[model samples]
Target: MTADGGPDGAEPETNTGVLLFLPYRALENRVFAALAEAGFDDFTPAQARVLQRIGPHGTRLTDLAEQAQVTKQTAGFLVDQLEKAGYVRRVPDPTDRRARLVCGAEKAWAAKEVADGVVAQVEKEWAEHLGKRRMRQLREALTSLREITDPWA
Candidate 1:
C-alpha cells in the first residue's frame, strides 16, 4: 500500500468530476430500469438527457441544446423523436412568434412519476448507507458545487 493507504502505484482518487458522474450514471440506470418497467421502452438515453433538461412549463430548443451539451440539430432530432413518441410536444412560443417551446405531454408525466419514485428510492438507500447527517452534508456540498459547476443553475 502507498503512504495514503491506497494500492502502490495507484493514482490518487481526487477526480471529483468522475466521482460525481458515478452516482449520476447509477441514478440514470435506475431511471431507465423504472421506465422500462413502466413499458416506456421507446425512450433512448440521449432523449432522456434532453428531456431532463426541459423546464416544467416549457423550454426553448436552444436552451435544451445548451443544457444537454448537444448541438441544436441533435437536440431538434431528439425532440422530434420525443414528439413522435408522445412524450413531448412543440408549441409556438408566446413571447417569440417564430420560436417554439417543447412541453411535456401525458406520457412524459407518467414516466416522470416513475422516475421520481425511483429517485426517491435511490436517495433513501443512499441516506441509509451514508446516514441522515452525512447525506444532508453531501447534498449541501453538491449544491454549493453547483454554483461553480452548473451554468444553468
Candidate 2:
C-alpha cells in the first residue's frame, strides 16, 4: 500500500509520489472513477475520446477523427460505441446533409457534470495544498516543461 491509502497500510518511503506522478494521468483516473460512480459504465476510453473531440456544438466525424489522432474508421467505431451506450448521437448537419455532427446526449451531459464535480474537488484540494500563487507558479512551470518535453505539443 502507498501513502495515499491506495491499498494496505504499507507506505512508499520517499517523495516519489509528487516527483514521478503525472497530473494528467491522475486526472484521467479520477474522471473514470467518477464516471463509474455516476453509473456511466458503458463508455470506453476510445468512445470518450471521440465525444470529447465532438465538443458542445458538435463536430464533423472527420474533425473528431483528426482531433483524436485516430483513423477515420477507428473514430467511427468509437462513435458507434458511444451511440450504443446512449451517450452520443450522430445527426445530419443542417448546413450539409452529407456530413454528420456527433453530439453529446442529455445523459452524457449529466454524467459530465459528475465528472466535473470530481475534478473540481480534486482541484480544490490541490489549490488548498499549494495556495494560489504556488499553484499558478506550478501551472506556469508545467507549461514550460511541456514545451521542453513535447515541442510538437
Candidate 3:
C-alpha cells in the first residue's frame, strides 16, 4: 500500500458499497440529465426517490414512505411538491375510503419514458463494454444480491 492506499496511488474505493454506488450514481446522473433535456427538471433527488416507488395503479403514502425508507411526513411533503408540479395526483384508495393513493400523472409518465430510454441506453453501453456474457452475469449477480439488499425484494 502506498500513500494513496494502493501501489498505483489510486483513490481507495475498492469496497463493495462504493463499487455498487458508482454505476448507480452514473445512471442517476444520466437519467436526470435526460429528464432535464426533456423539460422535466423541477424535481429533486429526494423527491424522485419516493416517486420511483409509486406502483402502476397507485401506492399509499405509508407504503411509499416505507419503500423509500423515509418518514410518512417526508413522503407526504415530497408528494405535495410532485402534486404541485403536476407529476402526481392523490386519489381514494378504493379499498380503503379513508386512505389515498399516489398515482403518476401524464407528466410523470413522460419523464419516466425519458428516464427509461436513458437507462436502456446506459445498459447497452455497459453491455458493449463488458460484453454480453459478462454483462448478463453482472446483472444476475446484482439481482441475486438484491434479495438481501432490497427490503421489498
Candidate 4:
C-alpha cells in the first residue's frame, strides 16, 4: 500500500500517527509469526523479554527480573518454565557460586541466530522501500519513545 493512501483512499495525515503505528504493529506480528514458524513459539512475550536479557554473556535472575520489570519470584517462575522447555538453564556463576547465571540452551541459541538473520532481511527489504536514512531515523525515534514511555528504565 502506498504511504500516502489511507485505509480508504483518504490522506492519513488528517488523523494522528495511527496509520503509521498500525503498520508497525502489523510488522511486529509478522516477525513474531516468522519466529514461531521457526520453532520459537513456546515462550510468552514476558519469557522472551527474560531470555533476551540473558544473552550470550548470561545474567543473574535478579538482573533479568529488573530489566524485564518483573518481580524476582515471577522471573524465577518464568525461568523455571523456560528451563524445563530446554530454552534456558541456570549455571553456577564463577565469580559468585552462590548466585546462578541464566543462559540460553542450544535450541534457544540457534533460534536467536536464525531470528537475527530474519530481522536483518526484513530491515533490508524495508530499507529498499523507506530508504536507509528513514529506517535509521525510525530506529532512533523508537528508542526514544521506549525511554519516554518506560519510566522505570
Instruction: Give the Cα error of residue 66 in candidate 2, in Å.
Output: 1.0
Question: Better model by TM-score, 1 or 4?
Answer: 1
Expressed as tens digits, the lDDT of each residue in 1-153 for candidate 3 is 223465566676567776788899999999999999988889999999988988999999999999998899999999999999999999998899989999999988889989999999999999999999999999999999999989888
Off by over 4 Å in 2: 1-21, 140-153
Query: For every model shown, what is its TM-score relative to the native structure?
Result: 0.91, 0.75, 0.91, 0.73
lDDT of 2 by residue, 111-144 (tens): 8888889889888878899998898898888788
lDDT (CA) per prediction: 0.91, 0.82, 0.92, 0.82
What is candidate 1's lDDT per residue for 1-153, written digit by digit as tens? 223335565566656666788898998899899899889999899999999878899999999999999999999999999999999999999999989999999889889999999999999999999999999999999899899989988
Best by lDDT: 3
As for candidate 2, its clashing pairs are: none
Q: Please list the Cα RMSD from the true structure of every candidate, rounded to 1 decimal place.
A: 3.3, 6.5, 3.2, 5.5
Estimate candidate 1's alpha-carbon lDDT, on a 0 to 1 scale. Answer: 0.91
* Cα distance off (Å), candidate 2, residue 126: 1.6
Stretches off by above 4 angstroms in model 4 are 1-24, 140-153
Which pairs of residues collide in model 4? none
Off by over 4 Å in 1: 1-11
Rank all candidate structures by their TM-score, best first, as comma-separated numbers.
1, 3, 2, 4
| Model 2 worst lDDT window (10 residues) | 1-10
